[model samples]
Target: MANPAVMVLGATGRIGRLLQLCPPQGLHLRLQARRAQAGNSTGDWHIFDPRAEPAALARAAEGAAVLLCLAGPVPGRGGADADMADHVRLGEAAVRAGASAGARVLLASSAAVYGARGGLLAEDAALRPASAYGAAKAQMEARAAALGAELGVPVCSLRIGNIAGLDAALGGWRPGFTLDRFAGGRTPRRSYIGARTLAEVLAALLAAPVLPPVLNLAQPGAVEMGALLQAAGRPFAVRAAPAAAIPEVALDAARLQALLPAPLAAADPVQMAAEWALLEPEMAER
Candidate 1:
């Protein structure tokens, strides 16, 4: 018997880089990107754009048991109609390719879908997106789920929280960075997951027998921005929070917790910082 083959779309991005740095064992990984890069490893590499070459996805997913779609617009990408449509088409392609086999599709979604709604959000919480990016992701989840059901393909949308080194507060830090302090003198708090932990979670999901249509991906607890900065020994200034500042955006992981084999311990800022430190050398080279 062979290990499950997993096709990773958007293999040149942040999470992809993290996975490449510390990939899971016992899985045959096939990495796909929009084009060939100058310095990426040459193993199991496929070059094609899912947006322009949507039809090619069927061929790319052949014999793969999992199609992980990490290819989506970033914050500055505008998340236009065309950009959001790319996810739907990619999901369609995944379903089309997996129709014959018992393959499953995992679409990368974001907590942005929760928008301005503060507090611990659940999978069933009503979406109230405030930014264009959030709106686009919310739309993607709906369209992908609907299409997956219609085509009899098992689809799961991972509503991921802030990744350790990929978030604005920590990763985007610079000298004289400013943070918003709310009325109670508390800095913003958000659910965060370590990059290595994220990889483990994904690998676990791939090996699971059943999956929910929608699942929130994050460590057990939320961390304060101040604590994270202190953990990293980064300096920043504090400013009064604006009216639009959201104090917290946490995801309730009860449903997700029930699915995992062991408990995912609550997020620790020091631990998250340490995990990100392991990938800093590679990040600097990029």
Candidate 2:
């Protein structure tokens, strides 16, 4: 088959959702839309919520060769405070669905899976998950890895970073994601990756020849806050905050590089900020 069929669980996310709508050359797409998103009549919308639409998902996975697990809470509406059953449910659902269809599962793990502290995390660094969210992801990874080992099925869990691009509260970051905030002149540093780059990474993960259930999927750069303001045609004192000092961690993406020719890994925050400032002219408005 020229295009490998893939089911995306979180097809409404910044990355997975975009791929379902505009799939690459080798992917024939199927998306898992939740109950509320049933009205989303875009793309090849499949009414499948990993948490509830298992039957629809099973059908969608039929004959598909890859499963991209990307669904998660958007902050508040999360799992029960007692257990991360929600995360476990999705992981289990995807594994079952993929095993039935003879497909590989690509799980969307997170950089947060590391912890809320600062450190340069390698692919195999010891996990020190801080938040309930991080702990849940750790549990999810265990499930994915076990499935991959026992079933001889490949599973890739990517620890993603601050996904940039639209949908982010900060839009049109032509001044850059952090820079746009600093344009107001005095903002904290942030980590970011272009949405397209993130989408590309997800696409590559499902197709990678070898599946590593745990991998870092972030651009290699620290988003400097001051640099961001400069790009917005505004000058502000910038500071490099310790990434590990923040909850949203920074990542080393050499692992992402070996996966595909997705060279956008170089779109570091510094480069992005500099390029933006160079390309766009400042308004004289004070």
Best by TM-score: 1
RMSD of 1: 2.0
Stretches of candidate 2 exceeding 4 Å from the true structure: 20-22, 36-39, 77-84, 166-191, 229-248, 270-286
lDDT of 1 by residue, 1-286 (tens): 8888888888888888777777877888888898788876656888887666756766777888888888866875443443655656665665565664457888888999998886689999999988766877788888778877877888888999999878988888899988999878889999999878998898888778679989999998899988898898899899999999888999998888899989899999999999888877887675
TM-score of the candidate numbered 2?
Answer: 0.76
Q: Candidate 2 at residue 275, lDDT?
A: 36
Q: What lDDT does the true structure give each of the candidates?
A: 0.83, 0.65
Q: Deviation in angstroms for 213 in model 1?
A: 0.5
Q: Give a tens-digit lDDT track for model 2, residues 83-157.
A: 455777788788888888989888877776778656667888878887778888988898878876777777778
Colliding pairs, model 1: none
